[model samples]
Target: MKTKISTLLLLPFFALLMLTSCQQEVVDITPPADSEALSASSPLTALMSSASKMDGSKDNIIDNASCLSIELPVTVVVNGLEIIIDSEEDYKVIEAIFNEFEEDDDYLEIIFPITIITAEHDDIVINNADELKEFVDECKGENENDDDIECIDFKYPISFSVYDVNFQVIDVITVENDRQLYKFLKRVKNSEFLASLNFPVTMVLADGTEVVVNNNEELENTINEAKDACDEDDDNDYGDDDFTKERLDEYLQICPWVVHEFKRNNQDNTVEYQSYALNFKEDGVVRMRARNGDILTGTWSTRVTKRGALLKLEFDTLADFTLEWIVYDIEYGKIKLYEEGGNRIIMKKNCDVVIDITKERIENYLQECLWRVARLQVDDVHNEKDYIGTPLKFFANNVVKIRLNGEFVTGEYEIGVRNSGFFLQIFLQDRPNLKLEWLITFLEPGLIKLENENNRMVLRRHCADGDDDINYIDDVLLTWEWEVALYQDGDVNKTEEFFMYTIDFLENGWIKVTDPNNGIIDGNWLAYRHEGLHLGLHFGIEAPFDDLNHRWKIAEITQSRIELKDLNANGEIERILVLEKKE
Candidate 1:
């Protein structure tokens, strides 16, 4: 399953205030003769001459010629609402204010103050009888009551038929420079339907300012205009035709709640997750399903704004299992998506495991016996038959003892079929250099015969020599052999014999030996081999030396020592030597 998550964020509201003020200036007034004004018959001329005469007077004039500047507190109402105005000139100035109210009904309205002229100056000349009568009637009607009156009320219901309603064509305008466009759009009260749109919408103003409508309409307009004007050569290019709304309905059809599968190597574990919604409600609710038919229902919540129906989402993976959520803004033919956090899905496969086994634990089911020996001490007396039974007793205290420490010493043992073979590795602790030997008896060799013996303290395999057919043990062949050496007078050259032995079980269990030809040979012969050979060595008073004849005679066989060599041979030997009874 493929899953995609989404979220939405709301834009902030903008506030606007309109401030207006007025100033009054005084001027000298002069009066004109009544006969002269009557002959001229111009009401404006007669009024102006009368205003000039009263200009310097401290008393207020009452003639029709004087222009009285009256400061009246005026109020205009719209749709049963009223806003106060101070003077007639202020009211007239406000009369030019025209605005379009965005609504289903779409209407245009203007509100302003009303002004009236009354009789006042010394250039008093009511020249025309009709004009005098008209002025008198107006003054009477206006002064009839002190209460304010509604004068100009022209309602023009707007027709949206002039503008094309295309969801994919958006008009983008910058809020910073084009403040009038911002104010006009902000006044639109019926914009709730904008939340459901999935395409860019353009808004064109009377002042030729175009803006794209979305969740972040102001931001989108500003950014788009900035980007467009960055490389523009013409300064009059602030138009809406340049921007086209890119439809996103097709993309939004693929909802966020989709399923995905994840697998790991070297393991039988798999994970599946699904995303449910792109524009989630603040209540944190969503619907999801896994690939294994598992259904999960939850909520996604974020603080992002929705300009053109774009929302953002965020998830608490630790608290839940999801990663991150991001909301995109669709405006002015462009989609701006914001990425918030890191991706959380991961798969791990194929790993190696290691296990460690201690020496004490291996000795429990494997160790047979242990022994230690010091330098032999004998008295130089030929008639000492009592010395035979009184052999020097070696204390067992100095003997190296093998004790079990850990758990099982068993491991998976495998060998290929045919002449094929397998091997086991054993690691041992180091000890002071001493004459040691070992042997191994496989309880079950399965199909192959086991020929094992302790060759050298450090076990290794041998490659076939120049004569490959001479039965030379190949490195791949698992074979075991052993050898021994005796030292006299503690010196290698103290006049003694050295012997080396190789166990050849296939040839009749005959031990091949190499004797030292040097007259004063006393070097210790070391033999290392695998631990599968069950061989033992006898090391006691085996013979008496014939000093005159220079040949040793067999007197009596003493104690026989036996030990099991290392199985895996990893720099350590198994302490399985056995003590034998003297004959």
Candidate 2:
């Protein structure tokens, strides 16, 4: 359905209402104790309030204000060139113009009458530079400590339950964004009404890790622990160029970084250094491994100056990567290094990358865990969907098996050394798309990237041997028979397609379906977690169940009911399926 099902959300209310038109029983929950309830003046409440404040430092190149942000689609003049700044990516254009010539003076003029969002999440209009400076003057001076917290944030759509003096539920207010949460917390701070936050709230840390807190105490602790855990990038620079020397050095030494992009003196050299890995060791020693198993030694050092962090590499043979580059962007598991002469390198960290690949190492990693076909493109056609719910297992003696419909399909695989590189060959009958001698381009402990002439594939390792969550799901699904309670596809109701159908989930990953006419159909089913939990189903070309052959996200699950949703590219629900246990 195109219509989105919004979470139960309510605007902040000023007055409590008495039941008059309808009689609905309100569950009586005791009012939170003074210490348990969110108090306006309490430290935890203050932290939450600060965390909800608008972070305006991301576009500091345009506003130069740490506590204020200029709304997008604003036009600005950069050195006599007028450009429409629509998104954050356009900020790099401005930075590039400013850094074009060091001898020339840089300037930026805003075509004003723009809206600015304050740290308090208030929208203000500024007509000229003078009017904008009024708010800019109030911001912290270039990365100085401020009242707003930026290292952790509350995952939105969280809600609070409003209560009356007698502790009876009066209303439930849902907050959809930071602005709404900030305004609502102000009421909580002023003691305008009695309210308590709903339990089991989720918070996201700066590094994109999610933490779920079930109670007030856990929430408080989670916030406190993550409040100061990351670099907020509060400076006026566009990216994280203000890293300390020690921090930058330690970060590089954590894992081996593979070059994803490379440019030297305005010439692209990505193909030559595509998979070249760099390992920064102690005592100024760095090792570089080439695709042909050649190891090159280099000296590396870092120094932080008033301008920014600089990384210098000295290699006798690898001259292209031997320049002193400015560290412009430091993100999780990635680093962006650039220099003035159009030299740049983008490296991504991979702790499991095998620098010295051998026949033994390749076979060991293949047999370690089950491999899921995460991506496959053959002859410009996407083919990964056909392999859903099927994971390949590698065994000893060149034996391979793919689980399909809870049964093992025999196959043969071989790892061979070629003049170009290591190649993986698969011989599976009736699977012509996967029967190519694919060159292994990238290899890591949990990942393998393979490429043929016009085909590419990625396999991600999946080890669920002892995962308690998967085990629990498997047990719950096998306990009883289930029937489709609802099936919605877009604006169409397709529940009757599987009328009187009974589904039995077997332990070996097969689903046994009995239709209304007593005809039996077998399908494959797998429960796994990637970003979130999902139920992968593959019914082949079965008449009615063919429409249900896709990986559905597990939205909710209980002992008797399971809710699954298929989301589109924008995360909107495209289809929903609900299965309830047979009574």
Candidate 2 residue-wise lDDT at 417: 82
Writing each residue's lDDT as its tens digit, candidate 2 over 1-583 gives 0001112234635544444223275666776777667766777778888888888888899999988888888999999999999977899899889866544789899998998888877777899999999889988799798887888888777888876656667788888877777778888798766677887899888878999998888888888888777778889878777888888999999999999999899888998889889999978999987765567899999998776899999999989989888898776798988887678899999898877678899899999978888898999999988888888899999998999778889999999987767888877777788888888877888888888887899988888779887777788899999999999999999998878999999977889999888889988888887888888888788988999988899999988999999999999999999999988
Span of 10 residues, lowest total lDDT, candidate 1: 154-163
The most accurate candidate by lDDT is: 2
Q: Give the poorly placed runs of model 2, Cα more than 4 Å off.
A: 1-240, 243-247, 264-276, 283-285, 288-308, 314-322
TM-scores, each model vs. reference: 0.14, 0.62
Candidate 1 lDDT: 0.24
**Quick one: best TM-score, which candidate?**
2
> For each candidate, what is the lDDT?
0.24, 0.84
Q: Estimate the overall C-alpha local distance difference test score of candidate 2.
A: 0.84
Candidate 1 lDDT tens digits, 247-294: 233333223322122222222122323211122223455443322222
